[model samples]
Target: MSWHPQYRSSKFRHVYGKAASKEKCYDCVPITRSVHDNQFCAVNPHFIAVVTECAGGGAFLVIPIHQTGKLDPHYPKICGHKGNVLDIKWNPFNDFVIASCSEDATVKVWDIPKHLLTRNITTAKKELLGHVRRVGLIEWHPTANNILFSSGYDYKIMVWNLDSNEPVISKPVKILDAHKDVVLSMSFNTDGSLLATACKDRKIRLIDPRSGEVLQEASYKSHRVNKVLFLGNVKKLFSTGTSRWNNRQIALWDQNDLSVPLLEEDLDGSSGLLFPFYDSDTCMLYVVGKGDGNIRYYEISSEKPYLNYLMEYRSHLPQKGIGVMPKRGLEVSACEIFRFYKLIPTKSLIEPISMIVPRRSESYQEDIYPLTTGAQPALTAQEWLNGVNKGPLLVSLRPDSRKQLKVEKKLPKKENMCLSNGFDVFECPPPKTENELLQMFYRQQEEIRRLRELVNQRDVQIKQLELKLRNLCMNTGSY
Candidate 1:
């Protein structure tokens, strides 16, 4: 087709039906995107969110993959925040209600539904003034839907009780200094017990949300922290950093002992986490890497405290930056991602939804593709040599099962023998069809016949050359 998947023909049912009806609730936290959730929600693999221009100017926007359904009658101008919108998020309980933060120091709540965005009501949810600089992030409480948190360049993290549109405690509940330096990132744990913040101070300080007291701190000098996440099951935290260190680092901080990392693994050469979210149901952490041009899904378990580098998905967007949302429900692993580009204050977010669904990413496509050592799941040293399906990596010469390498001691040299794992080892299993063996025989004979015919042709050509040589000799002798 001449058009991209965004313009190509597709159906919503085809997309939604692909998600299995499995629903598991992940702890509410920020994430870049979740494929496990996308699969459940039925989002198309290439349907990543962009401040992207659709075929419709701004009137109505297509949801990426399946061609023509418009999200709203018209996009809401959302013009209250006097400056650029640094963050935008939807309320978990209410899909129509969205909240956006701006350098103008105002967080405006826009109640807009997909079908009718006409109720474009812009209410100044809360105007936090203490942060002399721009607000960096705004996150809602995982369980307490109305409670919100905003962290900023002023190095302070504020907790607000957005209990009502006009509240008694509309002011900051806690304005605690999150770091010794500028606080770059901050988020609440799944349980709301701890808040993990990644700072320019090169540290991840765990603070109690209620009192705004520093509960624990995990410091590292290898690289400055960009984003820190409190992983699923409430036992560990995941973090991402820059090029000075392994661009993507999964530091599993034991909840019991927050000082040292139980498992600190690098994402090979992958750039720092563009955004990351944890799937409470699958215990998977999906990370979107910065300009590295791929979205990676990693599985982190508190029980094991080790990150299983799962898969890497290629994105069709030319986005320089992005924000992600975790799979709200459980039927799948796909997460929602919004890709856009801009600079300066540098604040964007991947939010959370209460509903559960599969994730959307290229990995869900029905085709096989190559993977790097990091993208491939880690196999035990024995599994790689054993021809097990940790993943399809072993090379086999046999047509049926993969062949195993066997070392044989010959008279003078060692002979390397490749053995069949299952398919051709001993007596063949029952054939699928009655003519299967006959079909194989015919195929073999056809190959052999073709080879023999080529040999015979060569022989005839040799004979003809001999006759020509003999005639030439006779002619010379006669001369």
Candidate 2:
């Protein structure tokens, strides 16, 4: 019998339903001859936001996937951008708050009404203006609430604090002006310390957002880079772009040095851009190309050539846009790890595709559970501005049923063994008395306390020595 039954795709419903109709389509008439990997669709824990380019402009549709037709007679279809809506991202912390960018050259933050299923139209809660050209990218701070990052064709990356209650000009808190060409894509490391960007000038740059300095920069003369991403907890990067001869390629690089890529592979030339999505818990990277019908995934590990091609999922209908659901939104009961929403422009529908692990047991298996990526924010925006580098907030997604489903097993040392004399012998020693175990625990705790004190003393001495060296260098008139 199969060990895992819940992981099969045939068990779960694949098509959630079309989000828009012929009368409500976002981009009824194509304005441009191309569709870029804009990350146009975004899904939060509850709702999914999709950008459809309209003839005159574009519209943002906020539809409840579970309640698209049943709960609400009409879902909220937001029209705020004067031009095409380039991208939309839901706030990680707030389900109702969404940030969108447009060709109108502005980023608007919208706060959806409480009764989102019934609400038809929603307006912007705040408007941020700084980019002189079309704003195409927007990313919220993973850990810090009310903070956002945006990039535009003007070659500027602006960091804004959305906590401000003022209606005046929304001045950015910090601006990064390093890229000479248009920023094609921008992504933050898991902790939000480093910001990686791919530009049209064939360069990939890592910037320190807090200090506004280029931490590391590398350029490739081949083709225009499309995306730069940081995966898992490793100090490495992945980039997708075309080579000099117009051959598509995906390469892995070391974060410290970009003199040469660690691993590189060539793909068939296609007009659609490749969008990468990494799952830190499972160390899997899903690569989906815009306007393509297949999703290719690779399992990344610490071994050489980190990316190991896993498998691919193909559909008859090519996707115009794709949105991945957050980990928490996945169906854990079905042993599902990732869920994707693929937008079929021809049908004017957003179909759901789930990736599940096939398992047989009815129990919740702890061994096969996925670790959620970006579980917690490392530092608050205010703290980061204050020059603090608090590490990530680690969280656990262990369900309560896990403990109940676990079966206690004897350790190898404690199990019975067969002796040479053909007699069974217990390998484990008899259980120690309560007081004896307590004594051992106390001794271990004492050693831990001693080690901690030594560390503290060493830190204090190191600080004092640094101060003395600074004073000595100043007195000697040397740098």
Candidate 3:
């Protein structure tokens, strides 16, 4: 009944032989929010952010992934949320911005310092208040910049546009009330047309973002669903959680009609929650479990059963949390596609795992290469604020961009303790004073407001042209 026996995995090697330093003291806090929900450490091209709990309580630590060191004594991480921070998400379009939801019932957006090498840089850009109970989830729209969706213990999902031009008290554009229980996780479709939410009630609901309507609903009576995600470009979905017998399970179902899963398989029971990272271009789903020393991936295709077991990559140590770098951040020259930053808090180390395809010939393999979603925002911050939503642009990695990587023999132990492949690591300058950062933050907000006004003007002109056309048609019909 489970695919564990049938699973096969490709080889994965450690990218950085040494672990990235953890700034905080190691504590035995589990990564799961509840019995089923798994928390993800947020990552971008520039930095990785993790919520840590020490003797002093919780602090949101944002560290440069490229650099390794102890916590800067003066700049002790950003401590905005009064209660435990449950989840954090990096803005897909803006590398310098991140959103964190906490048990304090608040979602705060922080502006990351451009230069991380300095000390004492903590700037809270905006604190969002709407949920009545602990807020657990905050996700940025895939295509829309600054448009964020958040859900909490109060069983309400709120849509927000982070344009600081408006008053702090009136930022939530829409408050959706449907879930009878806590909303566990949510995913937006490729085109941003539909939002699928998984609730603690063991039901998945497909929602109309514009109308706040529940278009369809599916139930899994077996057990509570932990995570639900939309399959790339396909009208299908995947969910992972527990079964009635308290076994871990993964299921694939049709989005239009989730009456029954196309495929459902049980797995070995473990307390660690499995967080899935999907690559739309490759149609591969990588499942990384907290407290597990391995990653299991499966390839999805347009066929019966839909999912084909690929392979698992094993390691020596378990992870407290994990963050995945975007596809655009991979080193294309090394035939690398995915890179995972594994957090080992016990050792105060962060390790990188690189998944690469082996090549022998000096030519690009057309079959294995596909265009990936670009990080660029589909619309400017102003356009997103003006109710414009669109899919992201795709960047093609073809011909010259793809190169054959020479396969090397596996190294033994500490002998291979060196950074592999050539990757560019940009250094951030020293941190700026709080006064200087506040001035820059306000200036950026003003610029976004002016851009919004220009977009509004264009909308008026477009409406006028439509009105004239309608009048001309009416006159001709009357004649």
Task: Supply the global lDDT for candidate 2.
Answer: 0.72
Minimal lDDT window, size 10, model 1 = 36-45
Per-residue lDDT tens digits for candidate 3, residues 1-479, read 76556533423222122232343222232233322244547777567777765333346677765544554434457676677778889988767888888777888887776765354334468878888898888888888768789998999999888865643544588888889999888998887878998898899899987668999988978756788899957678888888888887888888878878887888778867777778887777888777787788887777775887777887778876788888766555456678787777656556677777766553545555577787666875557556677888877555333222111333344434433542211211122455345434543554475569679988999999999988998989952
> What is the TM-score ranking, best to worst?
2, 3, 1
Models 1 onward score TM values of 0.53, 0.74, 0.74
Q: Which residue window of length 10 is worst by lDDT in model 3?
A: 422-431
Q: What local lDDT score does residue 315 receive in model 1, on the 0 to 100 scale?
A: 39
The residue-by-residue lDDT of candidate 1 on 364-461, one tens digit each, is 32111112111112333233223332321222112322112221212222222223443542323434543344434543554475569678989999
Residue-by-residue lDDT tens digits, candidate 2, 340-393: 877777766666777877777756656546445433456666877776655456
Q: What are the clashing pairs of model 2?
A: 3-360, 4-359, 4-360, 5-359, 5-360, 7-357, 26-52, 26-53, 27-53, 143-377
- Pairs clashing in candidate 3? 8-310, 8-311, 9-311, 9-312, 75-120
- Candidate with more favorable, higher lDDT: 2 or 3: 2
TM-score, candidate 1, is 0.53
* lDDT at 255, model 2: 85
Cα-lDDT of candidate 3: 0.71
Query: How does residue 282 of candidate 2 score in lDDT?
Result: 72
